[model samples]
Target chain A: MSTLAVAKKEFHDGIRSRVLAGLTVLFGAFMAGAAYYYTEITPPAGIQSSAEPQTIAVINSLIIPTYILLPIIGTILGYKSISGERESGSLKFLLGLPHTRRDVVCGKLLGRSGIITVSVLVGFAVGGLALYALTDAFQIVDFAVLTGVSILLGMVFVSIAIAFSSAVRSSTIATAGAISLVLVFLFFWNVVLTLVGYVAQELSLIETAQSQTPTWLQFFASLNPTGAYQTTSIYLLDNGTRSVPSNPPFYLEEWFGFVILAFWLVVPIGLAYLRFDRTDL
Target chain B: MPAIETIGLTKRYDGVTAVNELDLVVEEGEVFGFLGPNGAGKSTTIDVLLDFTRPTSGTVTVLGEDAQRESQSIRRRTGVLPEGCDLYDRLTGRQHLRFVNESKDADDDPDTMAERVGIPEAIDRKVGGYSKGMKQRLAFGAALVGEPELLILDEPSTGLDPSGAHEMREIVQEESARGATVFFSSHILGQVEAVCDRVGILHDGELVAEDTMEGLRNAMDREAVLTVEVNRVPEDAIAAVRALPGVSGLTTDGTTLSAHCRDGAKAAVINELEAAGASIEDFGLETASLEELFLAYTGDRPSRPIDKPTVAAGIDAAGERTEGHR
Candidate 1:
């Protein structure tokens, strides 16, 4: 009950803050505009229209918003949950309460998760409805799958944010570290893999060139939450969309990507909770 | 059972000891005052009691529970206003009160608490905009929100104006009257003297004196200064007065004679003066005050030693030895 009380208080304060509100409004506007443009402008032109069903266009529209918004919001929200409380001296007041340290950490995570979940659901609903009105087409199954993958991607980023927040003392530093980490996973990791692949090909390391790449690199690429989420999203929209594939075929094998994405979500958050539970603040 | 107890409790930072083997006990419902100068371990002792900081040695028990072992339980029943405490600036005064109330599972009626502390009108204002006195009052209100069984306040009167200080003192008294133990620390001797049932004076991390105000005064056997206007004051009469037990010093200003003697010696001195052919015009006994008593216990000179331990003796014999190299 006390945990719920804490969650409710945090949720109320979070929603009222100009930072969160601004982010929500900006993301809503951008996603709605993008959905409208994609449905109204691209399909009617038939300039390069593929034979894929319109459900594919709808999935692509939703995925575009998820890719652009989830990571930024996740990093911003979770990065300050603990470090900000400590910096503001509220940690002592919270510690003085009857709840255990574990309860505090879990309650904060739950509260932030609640906020992210609401924002994503609302954004997805509005964007999906706009796309449906503009294109006059929708696929419930693809939409559900896309929403699930987007939420999973958001959780992975949130977990990473929490992990870094617990390790840093200042809120600004924590937020920077979380953002840097997400950028590394999303952008830098792919660059490194591409370099490795080019170097391996030049050397002609083995007869089976595709198989010559290190298993660890493959594992890391698969563990990239953005890449995994993108792959899973594309597979779910296979019959409906003609959007560009976010990850190569080698990165999307079987259920490997989902298992790896789930690992990314659980492990970092679990470690973050452990670190938080033992910290003095 | 005692409401709070510490045995050999010590806290050390690096090589310096903040509180060294401190042993203290406050009886249940006692308004006990912990007195000390600026750096006398009073706040450290309170921190150990509240489990905000861990002690390096010994033990602390509050309300029959070991403070460190059962800190949560202790916290559940204890309300503390820590020294140099800071509150959430973004929260309104009422919000702060409600937060504390919800945390303690107590009733959340911020208006009543605010009214009691005389801040109801500004309850909706952010604490950041509050004056120092107002902040102190809000902190006090938070501590009293749950009405816990034991209230541990470290210099709770800091930043409070005279009226606010008086109101806080009254609240402390009220809390004690309702069967709650109130342990407060203060550098101001008069405030403690006004309400404390007993006080323990700490000088340089050690408990030098512990007794009620009257008990302490009596223990010191303080002297009363008596001024007498007399006719024909004789040298022999002055000598005779000095010769009496408890009479130590005498001075005469023309027809006026001032005599200093142990508290109960004024009457004997007067009787001796009258018999010695000195006609007395007026006489009065001045009782020792808390200030004088405090100085006597904390600021005595060791060169001229009395039979009992005076403040100077305590300072030199204990304070010096304990404070060496610290």
Candidate 2:
């Protein structure tokens, strides 16, 4: 009950923030624009003139926007979860009540996740409604799956940001951590993996084709949350229209992308809570 | 059971002791003032009581529950206004009060609490727009919500004007009158003197003095300044006054003689002067104030030559309740 009360307070407090309101507007605008481009722009430009391709095409087109927007939203929402409270000195005021440290961590996760979940749903609704009006054969199942998985993707990043917030003593360190995370997940992750792939090829350690990286390397690179979201969304919505091969080693199968995303959502925060619970606030 | 008890409680950050092997007990149904100068470890001791920080080695029991083990249970029954802390910026005063009430499973109307704290007008406003005093009043109201058995208010008068401080004291009196044990810490002497039944002085991470209103005065052994005005300056009368037990530093100007004597020794000095045949004209008696008593105990004296109570007088120290305590 105390945990829920805290969560409720956090949600109430965060929603009033101008930063969140601004992010919501920006996210909504991008979602609506991306939906127009998918429905009207691409069909006349000589791709998928049937008013719809396989469900994966529409889902894939929407992915890049969500992929970029959700991380920014999640990181912005959660980077200061614990450390900001500590800095403002409210953590003491909070702990003065009947809450244990576990209550605080759990409450922050639930409340921030609530914010992202609501924002994602609102954005998806705006985009999905436009796409429905524009296309005759739009698949609602694929849309729902994409919406649900997008929320999960946002939650994974939120969890990681909060984990960083809890472990660091100051918000500056947490901000530094959040930025580093964005760099690694959004840009640097694939570069590092491709570099590794090229070096392996040069050394004759593994046979690799220009069209596809080794299966193990592809699976390893997909462990990044954004990569995992893409892999999972594509494979789940795949209706066999693209020329890309689908077969791979068992562990490298597309379903494991969900496992990778779940791993990200659970592991970092689970580890962070151990330190947060033991250390003095 | 004691409202708060700490046995050999010690807390250290790095090598510097924040609270030394301190033993303290606050009984039920009394307003206890925790007094200290800055960096005196008063807040450190309070943090330990709330389990916000663990002690290096000791046992603390709040309402007879082990502080670390039963912290949530202890907090559920105790209301606290933490010092050097900030309120939520985006939350309105009403929302803050409601959060407290819901967290404690207590039903307290926000409007009534706002009225009680004298902040009814501002309760609906966000705390970001509140003055420090308004925030203090709201925090005070939040602490009152559950009618907690124990109220631990650290520096309750901080950021409050004199009128607000006075009103806060009245609320303390009302809480005490309703049978709640109120333990508050403050560096301001007069405010604590006004409401606390007993006061404990902490200095340099040590419990230097603990006693009731009268007991603290007596325990400090602060001198009473006795001024005797006489018709004529009698040489032997001055000598006789000097010889009185507990009297020291006798001085005179014209027909007036001033002497400093221990609390109860002022009368004896005057009697000795009269016995020596000096005609009484006019005189003045000024007993040590609570502020002076506070300074005497917490002030720097030469580190206790040999009678260091922690060693020689382990069982009998200044803060130990000798009389009118417990």
Candidate 3:
């Protein structure tokens, strides 16, 4: 109850100080403007269009924001959660209270996660409204699934940021680390995975390559929380249409991707809590 | 019962002992001052008491609860003003107080508490904009918000100006009057002497002396120095002054004679010197103060002497002293 009380106070302060509001505005404007631009060019309803306009539109408008903006928001929300407190000397003040270290970490995570979740929802809402206004009335289920995937993706990055903030002592270092981590997962891991997959293909050992390549790639890919969440999001929003193939033929399935995403959310947080519990701060 | 107790508490960092074999007791409703120079383990002792750092050995009890094993409960009943505390600079002073009060589950009116500590108007301003003294006052308010059973303050007045320091001293007194056991650490002997009912002088990770201000002065057997200006000084008069029951090492400079004597020996030494054919022009006696008492016990050294306690040798010496006392 005390932890939540502290978390609620943080949430109120974050909202009232216009931190959350500013983030919401920025994200909303970006999502809405992008969605509007795409819809204006495409002209989705009643017009003679290419095959699978819905799927292509959704992929182009929805996936870009979810993939790019959600992680950025997640990192921004949590990058300074612990290390900022340390830098300001408020960490010692909080630790001086009767709460356990776990309570402090969890409370901060909950507070920042609330902000991130709200910002993601609002951005998506504005974008969704823009899409619906340009076209006809959109189905609620499609938006719900998309938002759910975005929320999970946000959680994955939030957890990773919390872990980095707890491990590092300086706010600058923690912020840089959290942002770098997200960027690596979002962009670099895919390139590295592609290179590895190519090298395995060229070795002239198809069966051996098939066995070695996908398992290792999936393992490495899971290390990047954002990547894991993106993999899961793609699977959830797949709708039996365009989907990224599992690296290994054996590793295919939406459930396996969900498990990896869930692991990212839980394991990094668990490790952060463990490290925080024993830390002297 | 003691509100706080530590037995054989020790803390070591990288082969250097910060707090060594510390044994302390603080009674309920008593203001206990922990005195030490920098790096003499004052903060380390407070850290161990607050469970911020685990002791290398021994036990610590706060409000009848183990400080380490039941630290949460102990912390619940104790409020701490840690050294070099950095508050949330972005939050207003009122917000900081509200958060701490909420966490403590106390029905604290932040406005009133802030006013009592002389920061009423500034409570709305961002803490980053507060001066050092104002920040220290806010820290004091946070520590007292819950009316905790034990208040642990480490260098609470470090950055405070003279008036702010006076106000902080008053708050400590008020807290003690409210039946809270106040355990504070300070390097200023005058402040401790003014506020604390009992004081412990820690030297090199060990409590070298523990007593009331008067008791410590007495225990040190500090003598008063009497300077006597006379019409003519005699060698025999100086000898007679030194031979007095409580006087020793008398020195004379032509018409002025100076000698160190037990506190109550000044009258007797002067009477004897006067009777021995010296016309005293004027006389003054310097009574033992806390500063002198500290110097006498710590050997008048500007810095703490670095000496590790010998395990077996120290035990034997302590056993002998205990037996002698008994």
Candidate 4:
């Protein structure tokens, strides 16, 4: 009951914040605009020219932007969840009641997860309606799958952001940590991988340096939650239209994307909770 | 069982000890005032009692439960108005009350609480627009929910007007009468003097004095300041008055002389001054203010004319119950 009360308070606080409301509106508008452009302006060549075009074009249009925007929205919503309260001394007022430290941490996670979930749903609803109005082939099942994956992706980033929020005493540090995580995942992970690969080649750690990408490298690349989200969506939404490698290892299979995303969703918050529970506010 | 107990409680931040090795107890159903100036470890001790911070080396129990291990259980029976805490700015006062009610599993009406705290007109307004005193009143109201067995109020009168402070004291007295133990902390003695059953003075991370108000009053009653304005300067009168039995301090400026004396020596001091041939222009007696009593206990040396033989030793002698106090 205490946990629920905390979560309810947090959710209402978010709703009252003008910044969050502005972000949500921007997200919905962007989604609707993207859907309109994909179905009407410049559709994918084969799918658009086909006799019965599918919603595959709209689904494909969502993946790249969702990967970029969802993480940012989630980070903004969660980065100050705990540390800001601590700095402002409201945490004292909160802990003065019967609520425990565990209740606060878990309640913040649940509250922020609800916020990101609603954002994803609202954005999808706006974009889905636009796609339906403009295109003849809606493909409801595939579209639903894509929306579900986007929501999960959003929640994964929220969990990561909240982990940093709970672990640090300063909101500035939490922000820096969360933004650094986003930058590493979005832009620098592959660059760092290539640097490591070059060093490995010079040290004679691989047989061919310039040949096809190794299965191990592919698995390593999939570890980034943003990349894992895209792969997971494709895996779930594919209608026998995509190619697959023959007899890949179990860990390298398309189904493994779900496991990687789940890992990102759970591990950071669990580790942060252990630290938050023990630290003095 | 004691409402609150701490044994050898100490808390160090980095290298500076905020609270030294100390033992304190507040009995059930008593209004125990925790008195100290700023940075005297009063807030630090309260923080440990609520488990907001762990003690460096010691143990604390609140309402018969271990403060560290069973903090939730302690909080379940205790209401705290924590020092330096902020409320949710975007939430209305009524919403804030409802949230507290939900957290404590109580069903208190927001309007009634608003009326109780004297903020009825501001109940529906968001806390972001509240004045400092209004916010304080709301926070105090929050602490009164659930009819708690113990109320831990750290500097509860801060940000209040004189009348608001009086009302808060009245509420403290009411709560005490309702059989709830109130542990109140304040830097000002006036706020706690009327309502507290017993008061403890903390100085430099150590408790300097603890006694009932009646005992403290009796000690203070022993000392009085006698001021006399004479027609001319007389060196012999200064020496004569200083030789009086109960005169411990003497300071003179031009034609005016002030003596810190016990009640018994007031007349004797006047007689000695007249015998030395000084014609008194005017005279008055002044009892020590509560602030002075607080300072004398905390060792700040109350603001007064320069001391001849500082009255500290005399005041210390009067504070006879002070044990292990510097």
- On a 0 to 100 scale, what is the lDDT of residue B200 in model 2? 87
Task: Report residue B295 deviation for candidate 3 (angstroms).
Answer: 4.5
Output the number of the TM-score-best candidate: 4
What TM-score does chain B get in every candidate? 0.73, 0.74, 0.74, 0.77
Candidate 2 per-residue C-alpha lDDT over B1-326 given as tens digits, one digit per residue, 9 for 90 to 100? 99999999999999999999999999999999999887899999999999889889999999999999999999999999999568988999999999999999999899999999999999889999999999999999998989999999999999999999999999999999999999999987898988889988899999877889878666434665556666787768878877888874466667777665675676677667767776666555555456655655665322112222222122133223222122
Q: Every prediction's TM-score for the first chain?
A: 0.82, 0.89, 0.82, 0.94
| Model 4: per-residue Cα lDDT over B153-184, one tens digit each | 99999899999999999999989999999999
RMSD of 2: 9.9
> Can you write out model 2's per-residue Cα lDDT over A50-146, one digit (the tens) per residue?
5456344665678888999999899988899899988887888899999998898888888889999988998888878777777676789889999
Best candidate, lDDT-wise? 4
> Could you arrange the candidates by TM-score from highest to lowest?
4, 2, 3, 1
For candidate 1, write residues B1-326 as lDDT tens digits. 99999999888867878898888999998999999887888977887786657788998999999887788788888887766466666568987887778878899589999999889999999887899788878888888878899988888889987888899999999999999999999988877888899999887788878898678667546765555656678668878888989865566667766665675676677777778887765444454456655544454312121222223222233233223423
Better model by DockQ: candidate 2 vs candidate 3: 2
After TM-score superposition, the amount by which residue A32's alpha carbon in candidate 2 deviates from its true location, in angstroms, is 1.5
Ranking by DockQ: 4, 2, 3, 1
Q: Score the docking of each candidate (DockQ).
A: 0.23, 0.62, 0.43, 0.73
Which parts of model 2 are misplaced by more than 4 Å?
Answer: A43-55, A194-216, A242-247, B219-287, B300-326
Q: Show the colliding residue pairs in model 1.
A: A56-A240, A56-A241, B296-B311, B297-B311, B300-B311, B300-B312
Overall lDDT per candidate, in order of appearance = 0.73, 0.83, 0.75, 0.85
